[model samples]
Target: MPANEKLKEKISHLPHKPGIYKFFDDNGIIYVGKAVDIRKRVSSYFNRSAQHNKKTLKLVSQIKDIEFTIVDTEADAFLLENNLIKQYQPKYNILLKDGKTYPYICIVNERFPRVISTRNKKNDGSRYFGPYPSGTTMHVVLDLIRTLYPLRTCTYNLTPENIAAGKFKVCLEYHIGNCKGPCEALVDEAEYNANIAQIKNILSGNLSVAKAYFKEHMAAAAADYQYELAHKFKQKLDMLEDFQAKSTVVSNTLTNIDVFTITSNEQCAFINYLKVMNGSIILTQSLELEKKLDEDDTDILASVIVQLRQEFESTSREVITNIELRLPLDNVTITYPQIGDKKKLLSLSLKNALYLRKEREGRQEKNKEMSEQRELRVLETLKKDLRLTELPRQIECFDNSNFQGDNPVASMVCFKNGKPSKKDYRHYNIKTVVGPNDFESMYEIVTRRYRRLLDENQPLPQLIIIDGGKGQLGMAVKALRDLNIYGKIAVVGIAKRLEEIFYPGDSLPLYIDKKSESLKLIQRLRNEAHRFAITFHRSKRDAGTLKTELTDIKGIGLSTADALLQKFRSVKKLKDLTLDELAAEIGKAKASILYAHLHPAEGENA
Candidate 1:
């Protein structure tokens, strides 16, 4: 087929809506590009441009065909483009590789759903909230959910047998009353379901109902002469009220509607969607794109309206009643409701979108400024604290863990330009260290990490951070010196509390200015490293304790064990299956054996 004809054929299927498109070679090699109207964007390639760069001309020439995804808005298109380019590493795209996945809060669908941090959103029965601006923001919401709701975070399936056998114990969350101990049968199913209902209500911004219920409970407790219980209920009620006050209400115009606004500049576009349910703002979402706008504001608004209407048709119960845009939306009833609640809601959403755009721009500027400021501060602080000559652009931190010096493990986390470079994070199972020998463990970890770097001719870090005092710092320094890398890498240590910063040879630790941004950056990095190390350690510990009832089944070998575990993440889930269900899930013979073990009455043994 002729190239232009082939391109036209590809463009024929493209939606005349807002989205980004990609150009690919015959070998499926990608060249990323963005456009508000994908059909127009891809069609532009066929246009003869005299000023085209050699690379661009070459890319355009080799482009076998183009593929486009229709997005709700141009902003959504941009974000999708960024995500795809990051994933595919297209040859012709400007690749700024950052090893960070946008964080999402996934509420897993199960008997008792868990709210946890995830990077991937699959078509599972779960609801995902975010692409949070930062981990801190995600954590704050997660923490609030944990505190406010009696929800289970455990992946363990709760069953009657498990509760009776005491196989499922009350977790720390239960002790603190964050969980209602459903696993242990301490809370009835009705009450637990009620709690879940309240959580959903809270998430949907029905704060008044939750607050009112708590107040009623508080009054009842007070009348019943239970002052402590009454006080607790009152405290909870107060917290809900405070949360309601802080929330910026976006709409009172209508319930169950989403308002979308798109703002575009030459370099990037921003699309913000505010979800209004029951006349209150439930959630707000924003997307940033790398598409340039060519059309007038009204035209852009029209494109957004068409695309959004399509996307919403699949999810929303009814068609959108109205669209409020910066410019006139021709087909829709584009009434800028003046002087009432509807106006206030529209104004709030627009303001939010603009504020978010400015904030994002400001953050980029601040990150650049802070990077330079931090470089100087790190250098000056390292000079005084660790006797280093310059600031470190890259810092690698090492942490070691062992349970009473058994199954010793170590991890190395990296920070580049004051942000975590997760791609460089490394883990080690300590081979050389004995029980309680943290100093030796530190040495082993450092030496192994740097030795590999040396073998690969990789760049050495400007500074090495150990999660210990002078002794641990000294161990790391000695390891570097042994590798003849001591001068190349400045070594420092961070001790807990007193926030003491230790150096290799210094007897006393140094302290940075409490309010310094550099110090805050270091603290954040240090805490993340510690958290990662602890998580790894706990996972190792859990793996060691992993037991399966399926092990008793005669025919169930390693492969079968793996299959069963994959099908059912926990033994409780496996135990929940009947003989027929097991047969459906696995196979007949395997199910027979499992049934014999679980329900002997239904087995051949009976």
Candidate 2:
């Protein structure tokens, strides 16, 4: 295929699917990448303004053909991409090379199988327990199982025919009582299988079955006056409890999992992997990835899981991530532990990822020439995160405040280059709409604010933020549309619930990363607008109350009210005055009426 036509065809056919894409040439796959949208990411490479590095440009030049594998999830794509990259050793991809594999506990399939740890888990007839994060703790579990149960440690097959022929002899393991000497027919198959069953339960982190069995036997023995056997059962149960107490962190019930966390900046992502075995962290390691594209947390995490598992040789079948991750592992279970020991492990993993991110950022800051880079990075991130056409250098936020259908007011706060511009701050009194109509109040203020700006030829903000949800945002958008600035000005609403960002005419909220500076800036704007509106509303309410306050008293006209206000200056001071004291200021008849009105409960004083 001709290069231009092939490129066009590939670009046109790219689907908005989550998967891994490979760039191939005469030399084979030169680059492999995973994307939530294959079309977007791939087409971005072809855009002349994508600002490709020299290495990337050279790689793109060598691309003769493109191939892709669509997967069920971003995580599946991540794993597949990692595998393909490792298999082909793609030159354009950054490899996190490590030589260790995670270990798993295997119960060998036999008439009387042995429990042991191995690097690989094969699907023979045997039961496999782990791809444990920590080999050391798994080792302890194996030892604990051996300590609790008397299973054979011999190499002899101990077949039934051989035992019947009396061909096998007891070994040192039998002499030491580590084995029940099944080779010599001292132990039968049913007794050996029972011990194996209990071991399987323990290895799977379910001690209840074994504990229940032991307690049942102990109670029955005690009922029969078999004190020695009952005491032995009690000792075994106590031993199991002690072992579980030492290994378990949050709860004794949680076990056999790997916890993962991810933290990142614009340039890189730091992933922390926690090897959780038997509800305890056995080992932890943080790996850093330099981002070639702007990938989200799931993308970064999914890719890292495959690489981390492959690099560390992890055999764990259960994965606990700080956030939800859907991977296509039929044998593996994925979870987002919100509480208990698993939650704590997830948090610890997050802490590690955060620490690594901070350390790397600190190192980078030291090497850089200016701190303004941080500010630029924030602006760029804010732009991308909010999906703005340009940087939000100038932003205006609006809020409405009212109390019990009285004194409705609105406030607009302006932020320029991420700092509050108090000079441009505005407050509006609701004139067009009566009662506590928040949506209409928002419309009035938004229309008045922007219309005035237009009339006066004042510079309008690049962004308008409404301190509300979809309803208020639509009202504001209507105001803009009436002014013919609907599409010209970028307007959005920030709902207090979930800090959701809602666009005009859209019910689905856009959730930015909670830790994102863009979201923080939006939150700050919303809060500032709220504070400004509340302050305005309070002052307006107080003024309205005071204006009619004196007139409300009986026989007090405007003149009398003005006379009393002038004499006392404050209504509170006038209310405190006795009839005699008030009589000195205004005559006794007026004083009696004023005092009577002020002290409604004290009719005797009137």
Best by lDDT: 2
Q: What TM-scores do the predictions have?
A: 0.43, 0.50
**What TM-score does candidate 2 get on C-alpha atoms?**
0.50
- Summing lDDT over every window of 10 consecutive residues in candidate 1, give the lowest-scoring window: 312-321
| lDDT of each residue in 1-606, candidate 2, tens digit only | 235566878888989999989998867888899888998888888886458766567777878788888898876776788888778877677656555566877888876788778987787988887666668867888888887788876656777888899998988888886888888889888988998999888876667789998899999999999999999889889888887777535555766677788877877889898776666555677888876545567866876787777655667899989778666665788889787767787887899899998988888877673545665676688789878898878899999999999988899999887878999898888999989899998889888998999999988788999998888999999999999988887898998979988988777889999998888888888999999999988877766666578788767777876676554556787776778877776778988888887788899653
For candidate 2, list the clashing residue pairs, or say none. 101-313, 102-312, 102-313, 102-314, 131-315, 131-316
Off by over 4 Å in 2: 1-19, 35-37, 51-64, 69-83, 89-91, 94-97, 219-232, 251-258, 265-268, 273-296, 306-345, 355-606
- Candidate 1 lDDT at 553 equals 66
Alpha carbon deviation, residue 144, candidate 2 (Å):
0.6
Count the clashes in each prediction.
1, 6
lDDT of 1 by residue, 93-139 (tens): 64434455666777787776777888777788887765554677677
